[model samples]
Target: MQDEGISRARFLAAGLAGAAGALLPAGSAAAKERWGLSYRGVCYEVTDGETAETGWNATRMRTDIRAIKDRLHADSVSVFGDGAGRLKATATEAAERGLHVWLQPRLADRPPHEILDHLAETGRHAERLRRQGARVHLSVGCEFVLFVPGIVPGADAVERIRNLMSGNYDPQQMMRRLTAFIAQAAKVGRSVFHGPLTYGAAEGDEVDWRLFDLVSVNYYSYFQDPARHVRELRKYQRRHKPVVVSEFGSCTYKGAPQKGGMGWDVVDYDKPKPEIKGHLVRSERTQAAYLTGLLDVFEAMGLYAAMTYNFVTPDAPHRRDPRYDLDMAGYSIVKTIWGTENDPTSHWHWQPKEAFHALARHYARPHRRLDPA
Candidate 1:
């Protein structure tokens, strides 16, 4: 019988051999090194509050951006905004940190029919950030099939999400609709903001690469075979264009590695503050291991950039009681706790998991030489 357990590094590299045919020419190693860590970043989130006063957190937001640059060692940051105001606030601060900003406008409660309006608003923010001497790339939207309307046949986001989950829609049809929307979004984004533009394609979504400056994908390709996923990603590095992993991460749980992309929905949101209540086990190392494996693949693959799913989660806080342990549902590297003020700027209010150090270390290493594309 074959040995069932594989070392993390080998496990990540195992699938690359099959991808050799798809890689950039071996002479492109110098180019890959020159483009090292193109977007070493994290997704920073900001949502509109019920009211203006409570809608944003300026103090904490400032602190988070500082920490993202100083502590997290991120050179690029993706500010995920719900509306124009939120995007401006987050992206402006990210710019202040001397990090390139990928300004993305999001619509959580709304339908896909409003994507054009939302992208228009985001373009305004992108222009504003650019005017302020900030390096900003306008990412018009993310995962439209799940977030937007009309692409998947649901009347609203919830219905469409359920439709997707139920496997009740046609995949090919869904792709066509999604492609059309992405192309439209790119067109709209270009009209307002004449800068680098991209759309965060959901993993496994076949996108038209010619429409955008960067080929970005939100890759959470399960936990079983990373090499195979890297090979798949390698195929997308066509036209000598940069391929970016816009978002990829796992949660902090014992079985999170196996949950893959489903980890986010594994816990019920409305059930309670800490949706997962039980004699639950927390696995910081599991999160770290999964990340390290992916980073290994990313480094060897000579991808342009990779932004982890997120940086902080003020919404998800840690708790002593298992019933209130919302951090279990978070993708944040730091586990924050509400009402626990450390009185000043410190990583104390939030606890950094093992993955935090692993990321810092991986990023700090010299860029690996990669095959030329």
Candidate 2:
């Protein structure tokens, strides 16, 4: 499933049992750490805040970026968020640590000009990072049909999603409009950033390959066979460019593997209180297995990079009551909580789900060798 319309919820704290050691054997022999973790959770509302991670705290961000490089062992990170200033702040932290930075501008539910303006502004900052000797890639934007305006007749992403679900729009027309916008975006990016340019596409988006320096897709193996999904990579391979799966993973629940990419849908945001829609068992191992299994397949398929869905979602923190638990519906690897909840004396604000250790081990292996594309 694509990241068509993920409901944005403002939240995060609570506690639950997680299998920090229940790791399934990888689908194939463990390969080295070519994987990059996408940091999609930093949402600073013009305030200061840590794994002790509320928002834009200098000390807290240092720890977060360090964990991505040192703990997760990721060599690159795709940093994105609501504001360009915050996104740049996060990306700058990642860049200083000797990690490749994919500076992605993700301004959702905004007008087209605002989104483009964000990209151009962010691109200039990314170029400076590159010129300063940091490896930076300017990802124009992502999932345009849902995020960008005019592609569909809706004021925002959620409305566009509902309208599309009613199946009343023309597919060809949607792509035609999206394709033109992407072209314009690429042009805008080139005007400000002079490094590699790519745009995040959904698994099935027919973006013109010529417009990107690399082929990027949010390939969530949602209810789909990993092998079948890898087979679908052939068409992308035909593009003769690096193929990067920018967004891929499972939710933290017993049956989340079968739900579509928007599996977090189980949480009902409509109610006054955050509540799980039905009975559900929390299983961090399920999320871990789904990710490890995909890493094995992606390694074997020689994909350039398989960045995970996200590092942490502080807005959707863990909770003790399943009815109130928001982390189960999040795609992050860590369970965020109120800092004081962990320990009144401790600064740590999160607990690792089973996937955390699994990924650390997977990425710590000997370097993987790939055949030329």
1-373, model 1: which lDDT tens digit per residue?
Answer: 0112213433424354434324545655322434344567788888754333323578878978888887778778888868677677778888877988888887754655576888898798788778878888888888888777666777776677788889989988888888888888888998999777888888767878788888888887753555566556766675467777888887887766566676755456576233674555776777777777777667566677888877776656677765566677678788875555311223325667787887877666656333223
Top-TM-score structure, candidate number: 1
TM-score for candidate 1, residues paired by index: 0.84
Measured on C-alpha atoms, candidate 1 has an lDDT of 0.71
Error of 2 at 116 (Å): 1.3
- Taking all chains together, each candidate's TM-score versus the true structure is 0.84, 0.82
lDDT accuracy of residue 357 in candidate 1: 80
TM-score of 2: 0.82
